[model samples]
Structure formats: structure tokens, C-alpha cells
Target chain A: MMSMHTKNINTHLVEIKDYFKVAISVDCVIFGFNDDELKVLLIESDLKEFKGKWSLLGDIVRPDEELDEAAYRVLKERTGLDDVYMEQVQTFGAIHRHPAGRVITVAYYSLVNIEHVELKLHNNELHWHSVKDLHEMAFDHKQILDTCHERLKQQVLVQPIGFNLLPRKFSLRELQNLYEAILDMELDRRNFRKKFLSMDLLMDLNEEEEDVPHRPAKLYKFNFDKYDQRKKRYLGIGF
Target chain B: MMSMHTKNINTHLVEIKDYFKVAISVDCVIFGFNDDELKVLLIESDLKEFKGKWSLLGDIVRPDEELDEAAYRVLKERTGLDDVYMEQVQTFGAIHRHPAGRVITVAYYSLVNIEHVELKLHNNELHWHSVKDLHEMAFDHKQILDTCHERLKQQVLVQPIGFNLLPRKFSLRELQNLYEAILDMELDRRNFRKKFLSMDLLMDLNEEEEDVPHRPAKLYKFNFDKYDQRKKRYLGIGF
Candidate 1:
């Protein structure tokens, strides 16, 4: 009886060869933050079906590679940066999402500072489109982009991940601008400052912003040591 | 030039047919709360490699089906329940996580009232293991279980999702017990009740618990109307 069951299982595995072979791709929504606006990297689709339309930077997952490895590869190949913040947000496997045969793409959101961008576009092309003013994209990418952006908005509220988009030292105004860009809402300036201050996770660098038209605002650095001490209680953080 | 590029793209698509094919599976971590303990519905693994081991309720996703539809199908097939609250937590695609082939599984965490479980074991086996007392699971499911539990813990704090694990009417103690079970912490009785009342998302049933050994506690029902009215600001809710 056990052998019969084993044979049935083996037969089922063989059946997977014909019915379950799906092409898996990884599309990365690489979010970069400039001074006040949030941007996502895109490339013009070369496929005639999506000609002239922008699409996310993506590639087919290699047979031997892990899903995260595929996402990191896309990030490195496009941005030429290795130590960027990357997270797998969701998987998009709608039957008709891909124009080609059944391709299930895993969507990931990555954060990188716009200042350190070194595009390795070589032959292909890349552009950083501001997320607020995005045009229609190809192959359900606009939906993917929106989903990732929503995740980013929620993530920035609970975690200190937004720091990945900013430089080492930043003014309180710059931090508020980053939050506003991601949240897409105007926050009361004083309240935002008070809330962030109450977290007690910032260091008084005793510095000020340079190259600004108005009087420079005081600059402070995110205190990683304090945040590391209180890592698991990140849920208490909210706007 | 356009024809040459189109040919190159077609060649690449065919290459995907050969190499990028992978099997996709959806594993449901069905969490249930009964009285005090949090439990998860698990099934005995039929695969020989995982002989005598427990695994999540899951199946290979069909080619023509959407990912979410596949998850709903699994839940309906296993528990005989529909309209359950489910959320996709993450996708696990470690190259050799599956013994047979490169099968990348998406992990979804779902909440179901234990009273409603109608397991269709069908000559196989099923068990409801306490989340805290779970033994080693097959594949990377143990890690997946832990990750889902963490997400559930955070989710319960920031949303009114824990009510799904309970009956339509429950006591403050029962509610606190459910929270303690998911969060794995001993919440102060008064503070827990006070925090919940402050949310103003519960309706007093004007009744009390019956058939209990100790003093009966007042029962209340979750106010879905208020929650529906305030859906987007779920983040503001936290312990």
C-alpha cells in the first residue's frame, strides 16, 4: 500500500512537469528620494506590445538563484550599488498580467539615495520618474508601482527605513519633506517635529543645512544605537 | 532594426520556456483562537521525504488561476470555510526549499474561528496544533510559521483582525486572552479593557457569559460599521 501511494506521488510530480511549469520574473520598484519628491526607476519597454511605455527594471529569475538574489541582481545591475535597502513586498501572478506566456513576477520595493545613483544603463535605458507624476506604465507595472508605494507609506510610519532615502545628516524640515512625499499628505510642521522628537531616536548633530536659500534649519542625525536598543517595539511608532 | 529586436525578444521568451519554469505553491497558515490558546491548522505530510512530519495546508497553484484565487481555493477545500479574512504575508523561493524541484511558495496567514473548521482530511490526516507548542514542520514551514506569527502579532496590534478568531460575541477577558495568545504577552486586565474601550469599535451585547465556573463577564460584539467607516487609518490603532 505504501509503495502504491509512493508511485501515485511520483506520478503527480511528473504531472507537474507538464502543467506547473511557470516562468518566474522579479520586477523591482526601486524608490529613490530627492530633496522633496519620491522617484522610482523605470525603463522604456522594448517589447512592441508595450512600445513607448515605461516599465519597471526587471528580469527573469535565474533557475539556480533565490528570489531575493534575483531582486538584488536587478538592483545592482541597474543602479551599480550593492548595499541598498531591499524588501519583497508582494507577488503579482494575475493570469494575464504578463503578455508572454504564464510569467509570475515577484514584486520587490527597494530604497536608495538618489545622490549615489550610478546608472549602468549600457545599451538599454533607465529613467527616474517622480512617483507623484508617473505616466501609465506597461504590463500592470503601474499597479505594481502603486502597491509598492502604499507599502512604502505604511513602512515609513512604523520603521526607520525612510532614512535609507536620506543623507547621513539632515534637517528636520528635510525629514518632514521625505515623509510628506511618501505619505502624500500635508502634515502640521510643529506636530510632525514634536512627534519625531518624542521618539527620542535622533541625535543633535549641532549642524545646519547648507546651500539653502533661507536661513539653514538645524540638522540632526538618526541615532541608530537608540533605535537598535528598541527594535521590536517599532509598532508603537505612528504619525 | 525593429524586426531584428523583435526576433531577439522572441528568442529570449523561448529561452524562458526552457529555463525559467518554476512551480508555484500557496501555503495557508490558518490561525485560530479558542478560549485562551492560539492554534494553527496543520496536516500530515504525504510526501515520503517528510514522512511523519506536519506541514501547512497547501497545494500547487494551477496555471490558469490567480494567486489569491488559488489561496481561497485551498482554504475552502481544507476547512470548508469561505469569506475568511486572509492576507498574503510573503513568498519563500529558496532554490531547494522543495525537495522535488524549484517550487516557490507564497505564504498567506488567515484567521478562522476554530468552531467552524470542517476538515476534509479525505483518508489523509489533519491536526490543530497550538502555535506555542508547534513541533518542527516540514520544509521551511517552521520559519514560515514564525514569520507569519510575528506578522500576526503586529497585525493584531494595529488592526481589529483578532476578532476574526473569536465568536460574534465575546467578553473583555476573552478579547484580552485572544490578544495575549497572539501577542504572547500577559496584558494587564484593566489596561487592556481600557485600551479596547477607547477604540469605540465594540458593541455591548447587554448580556454576560454563561456556563462558566467563575463570575460571568459582560459580552460584546465587534462594531463592523464603525470599522468600515474608518478603514484607512488602521495604523492609528496600537496597544
Candidate 2:
């Protein structure tokens, strides 16, 4: 049996309005990769407090929607794409973080192939800014972006999340480039290629680079779909 | 310049009342170790909706306090201890998850030594329930408990968080037993000893077991205070 150390709530009909309620929102850190740079999708804020500063795509959470659903809705409304890979990173709640009021937002980071986005169909105010170049941001967006970037950097080392930010068919050079961009470091090319080859996570596409200034490199596709199907058969035993 | 894809928010003073807002609270799963079983501190729910159900110790977060301060306040109120090790695992915001009207509570788990709790000073309603035998709980607390337990398990593998749950001086056998309890698996004695010894995380206190039925094992204390002090000197260089 459990016991408590606090007073009971007086749930009166009129007292409901007297209770302290807060407005919750969800922020999406949409990350993409292109031209050897990692980028995040951002929009201009209309709020007068942070004029001219870019803000992450976000909106107030409706009472009927789940937190994850609210995040997905924000993503779809901005990107016009479904079936995105998203992870909820953390929740930001500070009394004065929002100038409008005490609005706490759950932050989520998503990885998407840059080519999948059709810019013409999206709003003109939306733009993809290089993650390395962002300095000033509306609200605490820069902190949120940095938190998600650290998570992505750690995940890429142990998981295959980097594939989501790349083309279906890519060369070993391209994959290494993606890693370098995410980590912001120059990894030893020989050791990196050898490590990937030993893991056997890629399929030989039997294709070559279409055009290049130097000799064209061979291309291969991530061999995950088949492995993922096999893993789907594995069961997680609970305690 | 940043752009918007959705209509601007109409922040009318009267419209503010019409905006959807939810009450936010914090629930703490206080974990204590004693009698070779993992236990969680729970309180009896006086609410008629969940009669006889055990609930986690929690309270509605204040408007002025940060989310972390609310959790620490709960821990201090219940166990009469400060500076506890607590981590916020995730926030649960499913519709109707709380029987109360639209309350989304952030769940945090705290590790405490059982001896640290002076039950006399605390309310009589508080009791420690064995985590392994718990099946039903008030609200969605069972889900919250499992989530925090999963986080604790993962943290033990890479971090020294488990030291918070054990006594200051312990034998190697006692240390292994604590690890086994948290992980719920048997580790080879030889390998476990070798692994911990290689890390040099424990200080040889030059002590011996005093009261024991059989031969006594060497007693050692976690050498973390020194290591932690050294780590504090190191800085995190950001990109």
C-alpha cells in the first residue's frame, strides 16, 4: 500500500478555472544534409520580442492531440512529408522562456533525406540554415538545436541513423562525408572505410558515380531493409 | 529571412482565455535498496477514483519554480534528504492519462540509500513497495516506473550512479550483489572483479569485514569523490 504527504485537491466545478494551468507546445528540430553540410529547417518568428531571429517550427499543443502527434503535425505542416523518423529529445520549461507567457515546449529532432523535400511547395518564409553557422535564434532554439546535435552525434556512432540523412545510393566517400559533417571532425579515411566494410551494413549497388572531377567512386545502398525485416521477427522479453 | 507556413497566432487578451492549456505536475519515483530487493516509495491515494491504489509521491509544479526544482522539492519533502541523484526520464501527455482534467506530469526517478530515510519525521502514509511485485498503480505510474527503471539500468552500465543506492563502505561481494540487483542478472565473479579492479574506481580502504558468519571479504569504498573532483576540473569544449 502507498501513502502520501500532501493535501487533497478540492475538485469543485468553479475551482477548475482557479487551478494553475500552463500552455504546452512542441518544437521540431528538422535536420537535413546537403553539399557536405548539416542543416536545420527554421522559420521567421512573428513575435515582436525576438524580431529578425529565426525560430524552430513549432505551435501550441491542442488539448486533444498527444505530444508525439503534435510534434508530427508540426513536421507535416512545414515539410509536407509523412513517415519521418523523429525522436523526442527533452522538454524546455522556464518561467520567462516565452515572452507570450509560460509556454513549455517539448523538443524533438528528426532526420530526413534532403532530396525528399520539395522547396517550391513549402512556405516562402521557411529556409534551411547550416547548423554550423547559426548564431542568434528566437527564444532558446539555439540551445535546443545544440542538444539535438549532440544526441545525433552520439547516435551516429552506435546506430545507423546517418543513412536517413543520405541518398539511397551513395559512395563510401559520401557516407564518410556525412559522418564528418555530423561530428565536425576529420576521421581517418582508411580506418573509417575498413570499419564500415567489416560491419557489412551496405549492399554493393554495382553502380558508379555519375559525374566527378576526379575518378568516379563506386556506389552502394544501405542493406538495412532486409536486416530490419529479420529484426522485426525478434521479440523483446520483459521482466 | 525566416518564413512561416501557418497563420499567425491571434494573441488577443480575451483569446488568451480561449487558448488550450493543461495543468502540469511532477511525479517522483523514489527508489531505495534494502533486504536484497529494489523498492519504490509510494503513497496511498485518497482520491475516490483510485481507492486503495498506491501512487507515486508528486505535487503540482508551482508557476515560479523550474521543472527540476519541483522534483527536488518532492524528494526532500518525502525522504528529508537533499542532494539526491535524480533524472528526468520523459514526459507522459496522453489524453485522459490523468483522471484529473488535462494534467500532464513529468516523471523523474531518484536513487536514495534506504538508511537515509528517517520514517519517524515523515508522514505515516509513505511506504516502500517492492518494485518486482508491483502490478497495479494509480494513474499511469506503472508505465512511468518501468521507464525510469530502464533508464537506471542503462545508466549503471556507463555511469557511477549506482553508488547512490549503496552504503559508503562495502565488500566486493556486497558490490557485486548490488550490481546483480540492479541488472537482474548473474555476472561471472572472476570477470566482474577483474573489470572493477582494472577501472580503479574503488579505493582500498585497508579495512576488513568485522561481523560475518564465514570468512570476511576485503572492504573497499568507491573512489569516486576523488575522481569526481578531478573530472570537475575538465571542461567540455563545445563546437
Chain A only TM-scores, each candidate in turn: 0.91, 0.88
Cα lDDT of model 2 by residue, A1-239, tens digit: 13333552311122334445688888899999999999999887767777778888887777788999988887887787678889888788888888767777788999989899865324426899999999999899999899999878866865678889999999999998999999888888898888788767789888899878878899999877655654422111111
Identify the leading candidate in terms of DockQ. 1
List DockQ, one per candidate, in order.
0.40, 0.27
What residue pairs clash in candidate 2, if any at all?
A: A2-B43, A2-B44, A3-B43, A3-B44, A3-B125, A125-B3
lDDT of 2 by residue, B172-235 (tens): 8887887777777777889788878876778988888898987988888887766666543211
Note the residue pairs that clash in candidate 1.
none
* A69-178 per-residue lDDT for model 1 (tens digits): 98897788778887989999899898987667778889999999988988875443578889989868888899999999999887887788999999989999999899
TM-score of each: 0.92, 0.87
DockQ of candidate 2?
0.27
* Global local distance difference test of model 2: 0.77
Candidate achieving the largest TM-score: 1
Total clashing pairs in model 1 = 0
